[model samples]
Target: MANDGLSAGAAARRLGVAVTTLRTWHQRYGLGPSRHEPGHHRRYTVEDMVRLQVMQRLTAQGVSPAEAAAWARRAPSDASLSGGSPDASGGSPELTAADLAGFPSAAPHPGASGRSGVSSDVAGGSADPVDSVPAARVGDGEGGAPADLAGGAPADLAGATPAGLVGSAPAGGGQTIPLGPRANPAARGLARAAMRLDGPSMRYIIEAAVTGRGVILAWIHVIMPVLIGIGERYEATARFIEVEHLLSRTVTEVLAAVPRPPRDREPRTLLAAADEEQHTLPLEALAAALAEQGVPTRLLGARVPSQALLDAVNRTGPVVVVLWSQLPGSGSIDQLERIQAVPHPPLILAAAGPGWPVEGLPPTVTTLGDLASAVRLIARATSD
Candidate 1:
């Protein structure tokens, strides 16, 4: 056997079992270490360790060690176990598609047919927790329960089948099956538009919009890039208007659907504006972003008179002020400094857009280019 082979004692230590147990099984059950070399010590591969662990979990649940060992010995050789496909370890493999193919019908539950006395069907029915619980309820923070792997509720029954199974079972009363975040054509279109805008700008906007779903990778690699490409076409030529319009509409709808974070119950407030700033898109985007982060923002909308902003801040006692001038004109920075001087002025002043010149922006104010920075700055201001 190879010298790398673990001694029986070493194998037992690795498996957290007594060495005597390992020797007893090896001697009696014919599971003795393999003698890779004619007269040398026997060796065991890492796969053997995993099989042992699986066997251990089973035995702890009242299975006889002999039966569990038998299952482990047969599992590696069983083609039904998916050809012992490589797993994350790169040593012990993942089950092959062929292996999983026989599941759901044949396996019912793992080791269901074994003599361990455990039932194959859950709750004596066809339902699995993946289907029985509401997708939201699964991870809905009530008591820290984890949601199912699929995220939302079960797949659509219309699409459910042996070859193409979809929706799971309905949770509770069985009258309503909540629709999970499955792909919606309209939502995808909006994502496409945001994608076209591209860059960090579109990304920040979409991240704020889709808060609950763990679709970050999908957004970055697929959706955002495509959206950015479309946006580039629009800026390069007017041919993308129709697509842009569709994207904008879908984004608005989807954003509207996302549950707004509960407003801070404390009297603290915030006032934001796009002063004489025709670029209201970024401002609206920021306002929505703030709301998602739990700030109560009163958006003065686009093109507010300078005097009106000063008065509103005074009346609202807002803790912070955010201004966006997409096309900052001459002396706009001076005008912002004047706003910062208002009585008992808000703790933070954030200015974005093109109107304000970079030079001479006051020390009291934060100049931001996109939503992400604005969120961080606002959060810091609030905490302080």
Candidate 2:
């Protein structure tokens, strides 16, 4: 047997499937690691990885696991994997098409463990944390999660599949969230993490994106999609509130992890969730994005009663105040009216979040659109 191979966790992340899925594939499909050495656990050879990739793609495309496995088991010996025969539906191919294209062939066999800090030993597989997902990428990728594998696969990170599948039984509710189609791998990975309530993996993927892509890009491409998707899941089933809370808390922590501007500089930007509106993740992203540009802002997180907001406004006398309301009817319009009533009203009173009304607002309040727009507007406003 050739020496290059990956542990179950490393293999799972590479394939973008859960470890249990991997275990199921190994046990039921006979696709387990074929390479074994004197001292270590059975490792997945490059060929083994190729097989798992096939399994993940087929299953993800809605093929029954049993049939997909049968195809996977024969892959090592099948030259048809290169030039695949298409199924009757024409939506999918008979072989793992990803295996035939630049994908499977492009992935280097694990010659020297996968990533910088991970080891490839897995005599007994390591614990999986929410099918540990790699960071989502945000530029010029052209397809679904698996199809985008060539562009977005972080083949080295050691992420194991969570015990439960992503969106399937998230937090053991047995409620499967339809993830729709993911063009962003990070969004796909983040959603999987949220479903598992996998805090560590969620943190890892988010921080990686923020640090590499900057806060705004990360929020728009990576964070918001997952949050919005999860919110929709909650809307449909009224379940996975636990998933939401964990996800929100994890997002808060990661965004907060973004370094703040120097305290010596007085904060001109004021951010707050609207009165009686507790959703503040967007504001958190805004704050972090602003901080990335070295602009300082005072964040008065979560719900702030109208009077309390006025008191803060009066004391700080900020130049810009961004009030966030997630949904309509959850926030009071009186808050904006009171801020307008203040003697030293901010130079720019921005109404952010979807909760704000599009029409009939005091002309003083500017409606902030998306995160990138908010960052640009606020960052520019703060400079002057």
Q: What are the Cα lDDT values of the candidates?
A: 0.40, 0.55
Global lDDT of model 1 = 0.40
Top of the candidates by TM-score? 2
After superposition, candidate 1 runs with Cα above 4 Å error = 1-228, 261-271
Residue-level lDDT of model 1, residues 1-384, one tens digit each, is 234767766787676566655555666555556636777667665556555555443333223345546665655544232223223223232212221121131111110110011111100111111112222222211111222211111011111012111123222222111222232211222232232222222333344325533222122222222223233233233243443444444444444444555645543445444455533333444555556676556766656777787888778777767675533342276567677788778777766544456577788776563235556566666654
Please tell me which predicted candidate would have the highest lDDT against the true structure: 2
Q: Candidate 2: which pairs clash?
A: 18-161, 19-161, 41-123, 131-161, 131-162, 136-186
For residues 303-344, could you state the per-residue lDDT of candidate 2 as single tens digits?
788889899999999989988765466446778999988999
Error of 2 at 334 (Å): 1.9
The local lDDT score (0 to 100) that residue 14 gets in candidate 2 is 74
